[model samples]
Target chain A: MMVSQRPSEVSTSAHERVYRTLRSRIMYGEIAPGQALTLRGIGREFEVSMTPARESVRRLVAEGALFLSSSGRVSTPELSNERIEELAALRALIEVELASRALPRAHMALIDRLQGINMTVAEMISKRDAVGYIRANLEFHRALYLRAQAPAMLAMAETVWLQMGPTMRALYGRLRRTEPPRNHKLIIAALKAGDEPGLRLAVRSDVTQGLRMLAG
Target chain B: MMVSQRPSEVSTSAHERVYRTLRSRIMYGEIAPGQALTLRGIGREFEVSMTPARESVRRLVAEGALFLSSSGRVSTPELSNERIEELAALRALIEVELASRALPRAHMALIDRLQGINMTVAEMISKRDAVGYIRANLEFHRALYLRAQAPAMLAMAETVWLQMGPTMRALYGRLRRTEPPRNHKLIIAALKAGDEPGLRLAVRSDVTQGLRMLAG
Candidate 1:
C-alpha cells in the first residue's frame, strides 16, 4: 500500500487502469480463490479514489470474473467440485465450436505457431511456473479462437478462464506431475484431420482432463 | 433540466439511478444502436452530477451492453450482419450445450413451467408487446439454462442477449407475427423425450429462427 501511493500513479483514468490491472492479476492467477479485496485496498494499491475502484469491482463481479459476497466482500470464486465440472463443461461447449471454426481459417502456419507456443508451455510446466503455463496455454487457444473471428464467443471463453484462474492455479500446483500432457499433439492431429467431431472430442478431453484428474 | 433542480425528488443513489435509467432506455430500444449518448445529457436527465453519470456509462460500456466511441461518447452497439450471425452462432454453441445438460434435469414440472410461460409469450405476441415477448422468451430460455447449472455459460449467453436487445426490438416490431413457430413445440417434445441430438436440433432451430427472421 505504501509503495502504491506515489503521485505519478494517479494520472490515467482510474477505472480502465483498475480494470486492466486487476483483470491481468486475476487472469495470471496472482489472486487466490476466496481471497478478499476491498474497494479501499484496491484504491490504495492503484492510487485511485474509492469510487472508481468500486465501479471496476462491480463490473468484474457482473462478468463473474470476481465474486461478491452477500456482505459485499469481493474475491476470486471458490469452486465446488461440481461447479468446476460445469465450467469445464462450458469450456468444452464454447471452445470446440471455436476450434472447428478456427480450423478452416488455420493453415499450416497457424499450426506451426501453436506448436511453437506449446514448447514454451512445456517449458513452463517443467519449470513449475503455473502463471507461465496458464498464460502460454491460453495463448495457444486464443490464437485458435482468433481465427474463429467470433469476438463475443471468444470473450465469453476468456471470462470462463478468468473465473477459473485461481482454482486452476491451486489445481495445477497440486497435480504438478512436472509436465503438461501430450494432448496438444492430439489436438493438432484432430485439427489436421479437419475432423470436427474429433476436434470437439479433443478439446473436451483437454478441458475436462485436469478436473477429472484432481477429483480422481 | 429544471426537474433535476427540484430538490424534492426522492433521493436515490445517483450512480445506480443513472445506470438503471440509461440501461432501461437502451434495452427498451428507446435509444437506437450507434446513437451517441453524452455524459452531460445523462447527468442532466437523471438530475445527478457528471461524475456519477460518467461512471454509469463506463460500467455499462464494460458490460458490452454499451459501446464507447473513440471520443468517449457512449452508445448502444451497432452490430453488422456478420456480427449478428456471429452472435447467433454463439447462441448455438452455448445454448445447445446448455440444452443437453439441461435435458436430464428437465422433468415434468420444469416442462409444465415452460409451457405455462409459453402461454404468456403467446399473449405478448397477440398483444404485440415486443418488450414483454422478448423478456418472457429470455425467461423461458434462462429457466432451461438453470437445469444445466452452468453459470458461466449462462452469463455468456446473457451478454449476447444484452448486446442484441435493441436489434431484437427492431426485429420483433417488423415481424409482428404471433407464434414462435412449431419449433418451440418441438423443443418441449425433445425435452420430454430426453433426446440429445433432437434436443440440440430443436435448440438450434429455436436459437436460429430469430436471426433468420432478422436477416430476411
Candidate 2:
C-alpha cells in the first residue's frame, strides 16, 4: 500500500512473488491489455531476476491470461466477442453450480458479510475507486462461492474473472458508477429462502447479466 | 513424429520446443505422476540449457500439468479424490457442451471417422497396447470435439486430460483391458440418430461412468 521504491515482498518465493505481483497488476487492470511486457522490463520493475520474470510470464501464458506470439513477445490476452461468449458460458455453468451448492450453506451471517462488502463496493464505485470496487465486488462473489467447497470449480471461475480484468476496467470506466445491482439483494433473499431455482437464476444473472448489459 | 537427438531444439525456440516435448510426453503418460523432475535433469535429458527447461516447466506449472513445491521443486501433481471429482465435474460440464454443440454440425464423415477410431481403440485394448489405445482414444475424442469448433474450450479440456495423464496411465494399467464400453457404441448411435439427449447421456456416461467404475 505504500509508495516505495521496493515492491512488497509478500509471503512467497521470488518467482512466485513476481508472478503474483504481475498477475495482480494485470488482473486489477493496472496494466492495459495488448501492452507488450518484456521479461527484462518485468524483471526490472519487480526487482527480480530474468528467470523469475520469464517463469511468471510463462505461467500466465499457459493459463491464457497472457499471450505469447510465435516470436515469443508477451502481452495480456485480448479476447474476441466469440471467445468472451464462450468464457461467459463457462462462468455460467461453473458459477451457477457453485451458487447452487453454496445456497444451502449460506447463512444469515454470510449474507450480512456479502451485504457489507457490496456496500463497500458501492461506495468505491461512487468514489470512482476502480481497483477498490473490483476487489470488493469480487470478494462478495468469492465469499458466496466459498460455500460450495469446490476448490477446482472456484479456481476455474476465478480464471475467467482474471481474464476479464482489463475489459472490466474499460467497462466500468464507461459507466457513471451505477448502483450495485438490485439483483445481488435478490440473490441474498433467494439464498435465505432456500429457493434453489431462484438462487440459481439470481446467481446466473449476477454472473452473466451484467455482461449482456455491457455487450448491449 | 520423429524423435530428436536434440529433443528441445527442433527449429522452434528452445524453450517452446522443450515445452511441447515435455507436455506431449506428460500427456501421453510417459511420465509417472508424483515423479520429481529437476530443471537440471530435464535440461540434460532434452540437451538444452537450463533456461529453456525452466521456461517449459513454468508453462506446465501454468497449465496445472505440473506442480511446483514451496521449495521451488517441480513434480507431477498428486491429486486427491476430491480433486479428481472436481475435475470430473469440470469435464462433464465442458464435454457435454462440446458434444451438444457438435451434434447438429457433426458430419457423416466425422461420425464415421470417430467410429473407425473407436474400433482401433478396441483393437489396441484387446492387444493390451496401452500406448496405442491411449493414442486412439484421444484421437476419437479430439475428432468429436473438433466438430464443436471451440478450440479454446477444447484446449482447456485437453489441458485437463494432460494433467490426468500419468494418473490415467496408472489407472488403465492396473485394470485389465476390456471391450470398449457399450456407451461408446451408444454415443456413435446417438450421433447418427441425431438424438440430442441420447448424445448428451452417452457422452456423460462415457465420461463419468468410467470414473465411477474406477471409484467403486
The residue pairs in collision within model 1 are none
Q: How many Å off is the CA of A63 in candidate 1?
A: 1.7
Score each candidate by Cα lDDT: 0.81, 0.81
lDDT of 2 by residue, A84-113 (tens): 777777778888888988988888999999
Return the top candidate by DockQ.
2
lDDT of 1 by residue, B84-113 (tens): 888898888888888888999999999999
In candidate 2, stretches whose alpha carbon ends up further than 4 angstroms from where it belongs are A1-11, B1-10
- Candidate 1 retains true contacts at a fraction of 0.58
The alpha-carbon lDDT assigned to residue A169 of candidate 2 equals 69
Chain B global fold similarity (TM-score) for predicted model 1 against the true chain B: 0.85
Q: What is the lDDT of residue A20 in candidate 1?
A: 84
Clashing pairs in 2: none
Q: For candidate 1, what is the lDDT?
A: 0.81
Segments of candidate 1 deviating more than 4 angstroms: A1-12, B1-31, B40-55
DockQ, candidate no. 2: 0.75
Q: Mind giving the per-residue lDDT tens digits that candidate 2 earns over B46-86?
A: 77778889888988888888988988899998888888887
